[model samples]
Target chain A: MEDNQIKNNSNESQKASANYDVVIIGGGPAGSTAAIYAARSGLKTLVVDKGLTSGALGITSKIVNYPGIVEEISGAQLVEKMREQAKLFGAEYISDKVIGVDLQSETKSIFGNGGVYNSRFVIISTGSMGRGVRIQGEDRLLGHGVSYCATCDAAFYRNKDVVVAGNTDEAIEEALFLTKYANQVYFLSQTERLAAPQELVETLKNHPKVILYAGTKLKEIIGENRVEAVLAVQSDQHEVLLSVSGAFVYLQGGRPVTDFIQGQLEVSQSGCLIVDSSFQTSIPGVYAIGDVLCTHVKQVVVSAAEGAIAAMAIEKEINGRSRMMVDWSEKKQ
Target chain B: MNSVIHVNDDQFEEVVLKAELPVLVDFWAPWCGPCRMVAPLLDKIASEYSGKIIVAKVNTDENSQWAVNYRVQGIPTMLFISKGQVVKTQVGALSESGLKNLVNDFLAGKN
Candidate 1:
């Protein structure tokens, strides 16, 4: 027993040595499954995620089709169970929004809002919830007055009017952050109601600095060299132009979250990430799974299965083995 | 034999505006995701161009004087300056190839 204890201690130390073996982006079902398998096989694993509700599953009210569980549970609960399992198997989870990755080198670097993480393998499971298209003039004047990050550029608009666009909780949170610096914060929600908690929505409506514009769509950002104004359309087809110094857009769409890649990997014409049978992308060490793939079925079971396959494949590649060693049973007879 | 130089408001004039080589001034901040996305590309440019052009970074969070002077309202805003004048201004992140093309064009005296 003492010998076994010493061996386990040494193994833990080895896993915690210099760098991680695998870093999974997004803590959804697919990413968590990958982490669970990798960690169970004695590899260092780290999962970076925005939050439980950032993915499509996060917003799902009920999940009835997940295997083995007959009772209906919320999507977030199922994700939580997977996360718990992964953590139990020695996977580290951090709540950070991943913005970019450097996958060209041997040691891939993943940058997030909190810090930068490096690993030998990277798994792209940041499920599709990204903005598919850019608004008019948004591309041209991106750095002038049309900004995306409120924390980074809010100081640039001190005592100036700004418009925050979107309906997600992320948009509301950023708009609230901008209220501290900007004189007037006009929130334009494409939907009539904000997709956030009731308490947070009430706070936004009550904030004196915030002006709620529900059921309004942002048509164009009118600017030449810098952001001058924004033209928005209401549900009644009424046009309203608001003169602001900055336009902070936090809009989300039904697309893969690969824009931060910046043409680093191969992608399909429809913006889906291309991967081999083992879920490995064009880059040898990088892998993508889940809804990010156009050929993938939008089901939790399929994503989890893909995650398992990718983890096993990575294990084989790292160990220089011809075939993967499947873990069928864990009972020590 | 060169790396990206982090210029401050005090050293803006000597480092970026009055430099002998063409300057690619990157206005960035750490908290911004887009700024972080373009960082590696700038690092590559700084080493590849070396003495031909200078890749300078200005952290708007720390030094806002130069950012304000250039009327920068967004993170990762790049200013292509030549002969101590603003040649062009680009907002947001660009792909590796796009950035390389931009640098090449700037070196060949294209705005």
Candidate 2:
């Protein structure tokens, strides 16, 4: 009976409508920053999340580059501080995983674990997740040899021959890191030109232990029960065999996780949210921010700044509407 | 809390349609998964572009008439209106940059 009541209450919350000034999704840096700004601006804002801790920051061990921090700090600690600050400013935090959104209406409806929330403005700060490599025997040998994050698994392959497949800056960076511990690091790039930054390209070129292969695609990760080697095809149309003990396959490319609203909101070819300078989507009262956006850069600081900007914009909009209401009332009197 | 504007159909025309800046209307409904994904993104954009744009949301399930008038066939639909004219319509979840580019284009009179 109690379970039924809880379920019924959850359903009722979805149906019981109350208009909020601003509703923020995600509690990461971007979402937290937006909440702080919105609450400070005197907006009745509500922030919802699935208790996923910090976004990417949660996974990082040490963050040395963020501004204002004198000494190095853990990513998790920084995120905790940000959360504390946002909460202090009267930003309502709710533990809920959002399942749907209604952006076509005058009042936006957000459906989630906590039920439904109606708001004048909605902001999407949900970031992207890492993609998995699709290959036979890869899933079964995930823990044995196949890995994505080099930092997490680099120590396991110390003094062993390892292969890293990718062409982006991240891939190159990971390969360089692997070179620190591995006896030999095979950096495989599917394209002729290295897609990494110039500095990384120079470093990879100079490294004696690193064998940079251009126009080579990883065909399969071969191993009996553990990763032993990887088969590849060179640009010269020749099959090349590379022997290694461990393999790191980086699959950074994938469609955005916006399939939930198939026909609801405007999405780009890459599955990113399409917004204007004001961060407004095709639907009114709806906004988007951070890496989820279709932009050139997907840095953490940039996304946080976007969140702050969105909060301030919503505050001004609310103020403008109220002023108009007051003026009309005075005129009537 | 002070900045909040409780607007309904009765006052939408005056509070949103007749506003000075471009009005961004978010048409959303409950039980929408993508809408949930895009909610925080919208909030961030609203705060970022505060003085430049007007952001608001409409619940389609409650305000069925308004949703029908706009021909909203999906959840989380966003409409960009400028000077009382519907300038652009986005039909799916969008990223911050994606939405910002469109808003910038609208602000720059690019339509």
Candidate 3:
């Protein structure tokens, strides 16, 4: 009995030192569902995300179309419930932005803002980013004159003119921040009315340094090496040229946030990660799901189903056979 | 004043600006949803970096002097103060690990 206890203690220590069986790289519905399935199957799982409110689902105001829930629920509330369910199943969660990843080896390595983590299976469900203006020369001049993060890149355009495209809360906030550094800030909203909060809208509209252009569509971001001007069409269908050094876009449409693992996976033109019916990517032991995957529908229900499929597929691949077999005996031995 | 110190107008100077370690000031209000979310994160950060940093909170409703002085227009604004000077300021709610990264980056002098 003493020898058996010693063996059990050693086994527990070894298990504690082993890496997680699966590491999910997003905490949306898809990743959380995958974590639930994987952890319930007795596999160690970890879900790492940038933050609780970083994903698109996190920012969605309301979700009334999701089935089975009669009353409308906030997107954040739904995500929180999913996260709690995943935690109940014994899946560990970390709120850290993944900076780098290497999935070629037996044990995948994920380097995040917090620290390094290793897992046997890597699931890329990083979801999508805010859509960008897909105009001509927009992609060619990303860093030279275009920027997404006002906090990170706003200082570069000090005492110069800049154009902010979009009418959301983030755009208003970034435009407000730009007023601190730029000489004049132009806010071009595609729609006639801005869709931000009342307080924020009032502040930006009344600001002396801001120039509001309603019902404007971005025709092109004109420049060679740097952003020299922005060609846009006003509500009257008149083309207007705004000479600026930087143009920031914050559109509403979804664009996959797969920059961290672009070359590592087989991604479609729209930035969606391609996967087989089993949710497995081109690489072995690697899977993609949720808004990051190229699915016909990007609803929560579909993503959750895909996550379950991927988790079962991963279990079958790792355990060598299905665990669905039952043992029956007519007589006791 | 154990892990997360609640500083008012009177104790602000001594507990935050003149403290031995770097201080993180979280300016919050009770009505703010994001502030409520970030309050626990600040507590976790305080416990994690006990010796290296100090975390403090100032209720903007009760104390408007510091808020006006810093021109804080929003709730859930965190100010990183070191050597009696405000170094970095972020306005929004961050996750526990995200807040940890900010503290680590500040300690490493990267931000």
TM-score of chain A of 1: 0.82
Docking category for candidate 2?
Answer: incorrect
Candidates in descending TM-score order: 1, 3, 2
Cα lDDT of model 1 by residue, A122-216, tens digit: 99998888877899999888878887777667878889999999876667777887887889999999989776667778989999999999999
Model 3 / residue A96 / CA error / Å: 7.9
- lDDT per residue, candidate 1, B1-111, as tens digits? 799999999999998888989999999875565676688889999998998999999988779898888888877789999978989887776667888999999999987
Q: After superposition, how far is residue A283 of candidate 3 from its true place, in Å?
A: 2.1
Cα misplacement distance, residue B54 of candidate 3 (Å):
44
Candidate 3 residue-wise lDDT, A1-333, digit = tens: 432432353344233324889999988888888888888777889898755555677667798988887788866678788889889989988755565566667888665533456899988887766354487777766655676545434545668899999776668877887787788899999889776656778999999989999999877998876788999999899999999988887665667776556267776776567789888888899998888765647788888877888888888878888653122434435
- CAPRI-wise, candidate 3 is incorrect
lDDT of 2 by residue, A1-333 (tens): 422443454465554446779888777778888887888767888887644332455545587777887687765577667778887888877756565676777888776634677898999877664344576666655645777555435545768898888765557777886787789998888878765446768999789989998899887888875678889889888998888877887644443334334457887776668888768788877888876675726666777788877777777687875331211335657
All candidates: TM-score: 0.85, 0.45, 0.50
* lDDT score at residue A2, model 1, on the 0-100 scale: 30
Among all windows of ten consecutive residues in candidate 3 chain A, which has the lowest summed lDDT? A324-333
Q: Write the per-residue lDDT of candidate 3 for residues B1-111, one digit (tens) a residue.
A: 249999998889999899888999998765443555576668888887888899999987678788667755455679999988998877655555577889998988777
For model 3, the DockQ equals: 0.02
